[model samples]
Target: MDSTPGVTIDLTVADQDSKRFGSAPSPIKIGAVRMHGWQVHPISVASDQFDGADAYLVKFNYELGTTPDTPEMNWFELGVELREGVVVDAIPHHTQPTQTSVSYIVNDHLNLVPATNGVTPAAHLPATGETIHVFGVGSSGVRWQYWATSDTGVRWGSRVAWLVTLVDQETTHLDLTTIVRFDQRPTLDWNVLPAVTPADLRIELPTATNPRAEVTTQPANGTTVALLPSSPRVFISYTHDNNAHKQLVRDFANLLIKCGLDVRLDQFASPARKDWFLWANDNIDNADFVIIIASPKCLAVGEGKIDRNEHPGMHCELGIMRDRLQGNRRLWEQKLLPVVLPGESLSNIPVFLQPQAMDRYEIDELTEDALGDLLAAIHHGTEDNSRSPVVLMATSARRALADS
Candidate 1:
């Protein structure tokens, strides 16, 4: 099947009872191969981080391979998936203006794929399938783990990536856009149902001019379904001891994905699973914000045979992202971020989440004006009241405070 126009017919070695392409070992040192394109911006409704919410948070990516002639050991990985759509509103008059019905539904025989790599191995699931049937509205709902991927030697072969968490009940946030597609069908149609247009949806983010999803009824360019992104979706809690601090936290998450932001890492775990600390806590509990690299052998606790705790695997992954951000709303006690390396200590975190703590971001003192002032304090730190830079001058001074 290597006819190789855009390839996707490997079909796991024509299934002669495949055991990883009959036992992986070729040029396969497999590390750097990436191409991007993603969008899952809804960082806070119940809140997580990245403050910018308009909705429809999930768009795939491309070009995951075909550059790796040692393109710096090939490192590009972005994956995101949310296989649950059809959450409707506008049924109040329902006369079919742009057509919106189905007052109740959820996973109507759900089976669609291509969120991105990783989760495609439940017998390769018909090579990344996409939308067969899903219909719901009114009470609109979907969260049964239909899809998710993007982290495993940073991905290759196929791409559409999704893995952002602060406390996912079915994907919280993940925006990745890296187009190059020669073809594997991801030109996107997904059997219609409100596809594309939110500005040609490729979602890597941050250029903002505000034409990113706003269709009250219809026709600005038509098609609707986007309601997610409050801002602050970052999670990087490392410890493989030291591959130079995991390449300095993966070049500090590729400079916050080149300052558009939407990063997630733990070296993309999943080495055919040996319980990599329970699969890196299922992608660090769907991060809104959690970055801990406070080393001293990760805050030492053992040292004889080499069980030096590493702050109990980052306090058991920040206690499962603070118990799933207290079931969504306490936003993990106001979005956690700590980078206190260089001989650690802000008393080693946890002084009630360390009072707005995001200590001087030490990667031996990195700067781009300290990562754009820590990405503008993670897009204006939590409870983002529509990203208050004074809420658009308090809604344009509410008619001069009600005409004095």
Candidate 2:
């Protein structure tokens, strides 16, 4: 039960097909009770193996006390290994042998019982010499086991193959599994998130090569259900000189919400706080996107500014947002769509953001036509693939608006 300690796994990748190749052996660690031990063994060994020929196989062998009428069900616990620079690719394959079989039932009192077996069939399990994808670690090593709250609870996993390219296979594979989960689970609704920077988007664990499978560190404790609420996204960022435009911005954000887009906005700062900058910085650090209400008042710095210990100016938030989005050029572009509300001019726009045009909407000049165009752009920004293209178009529009 305490197989992988402190490790978190995305339940969606359990039982999925994973593939990788290397001459060096990626060691795997496993744990189990008496007579039942789980093992993850690689099938393809190569001074150098052919492309796609390298594979890892998962084996679950356990003894169950057999009894007449009431048979024991096999309870399995497996483990997965990983290392740095390893690229896990999904391979869709489902062919596992059945696990449930007629065996003696071990009663709680360790007495012989003739009761109906409750174990479901585990047919089509991983064959010998097959590459198996791992999800996460349990108590001891990275144990891979079928986990459901109860039989009535649903099980979710992908049968996709994963390709792992290790930078150095000689170091030994870390006794860990990659954590994965779907944006929408337990709910029938299908939610899709843009492929943001994997590193910045989430936290990763360290690798280990020891035979004992010592748990080095605990994975991020944020659960899939917790990190991903039923909402579409998470937002928390700055309150700036655009305070006057708050009403209009909220109106636009409300429209986005009506269209089912999750918006995170903090309308009023706590009147009790003196150091508002630090608090605002922390907010921007966690948000999926930071919306900058670009205006002369927002961008222009007034005279006599000092002790700038930190500031929550629109530009300040933009700088922090940019840092968080350093690598993910695509998601950064998609999530951070600039809105040129009425009275805002693009004359002093920053340099880095100049490449991509901003989504220019003269909210002041709001006719149904302008609103419609703006809505269309916002709609496009909702899709996963729309970041780059949408940012490009928005940038161009902003440029045109500036020129005109």
Candidate 3:
């Protein structure tokens, strides 16, 4: 099945929840698959923060009937800024009805009977959504369904929502059933990924304003699995050099974003009233990778050549990074990425990082080869090859000593 095209949602920021209930006053897009009508009950969880809870408990109504078992889930995104340098995700919600859910037997045919890839119980399925197929076990037996959704064209994530009527008010009997056997579905060891930015919301599709639904983007071609892998959090380190160098770094960061990485550059960090030095330290600790842009100005601080009172933010950050690398040899090899700009002398590498293996951008542009290498290094898994650089250096030293 062809993938469903996505609709970008515009999110408005409100200082307070006015309890208004028309068109979703919040920048959040909710409700997918309009049956008859459903209620949006605002339920408080441990924390309303995106990390812990949702804006509300939106219960989709009606049973999976003639409408099409291949249902489209709703895409949601709230643009309200909770704080500086922090981002939230536009989450697509779809699950089995609370009152009724049944397990379906796994069938390997047509990506059905998923022997390995885990299956999620979906109420709104597509007759043909994506290339993969969905099967739900019913009281009688199991059956397959096709589903599809659209892409929002957003670099990170796609956001949209749908609506339906109240099924209870309808005269026809609603059927809520499922066959769910967790162990028989896909494996749970899939990678988890962070959410991306939503697409522009101005685009609209001509459909009955009341009954509509959105679906999650299938993971890949020929297979449908959970969207679990997250982009690594990369902290970009650079000096407050001339606009040219700064622009270069900014462009580099944008390229990383395009390549599916959560870049934490200082400009985007927006330290606000926070102590800039302290902010750098905290950002470094939280980041999965720290990229040090090698330039004359950037190297000055790392080399401790600049006076403490003059401007030590970068210097201080370098100190913190070096200490982190020294303390955790394992993290140093994996987390620290030393990048040099075009025309930068080899000696200009940060004094603390000179001994470390590094990569340089050959041209002024973000080359595919350079980007690929950086990405590979940043997102490398901790498999049998998880040996740190220190370990490799030590082993090489032993070999040399024995030869001598």
Q: How many residue-pair clashes does candidate 2 contain?
A: 50
- Candidate 2 residues lying further than 4 Å off, grouped into runs, are 1-239, 268-288, 301-315, 355-378, 385-404
| Candidate 2 local lDDT, 62-84, one digit each (tens) | 22121122211112223333423
Query: What is the TM-score of candidate 1?
Result: 0.25
TM values, all candidates: 0.25, 0.31, 0.46
lDDT of each: 0.35, 0.33, 0.39
Q: Candidate 1: what lDDT?
A: 0.35
Query: Which tens-of-lDDT digit does each residue in 41-111 have in candidate 1?
Result: 33223232112222333323344333343222122222222222222211111111233221211110111
Off by over 4 Å in 3: 1-227, 355-364, 381-404
Ranking by lDDT: 3, 1, 2
TM-score attained by model 3: 0.46
**Leading candidate by lDDT:** 3
| Winner of 1 and 2 under lDDT | 1
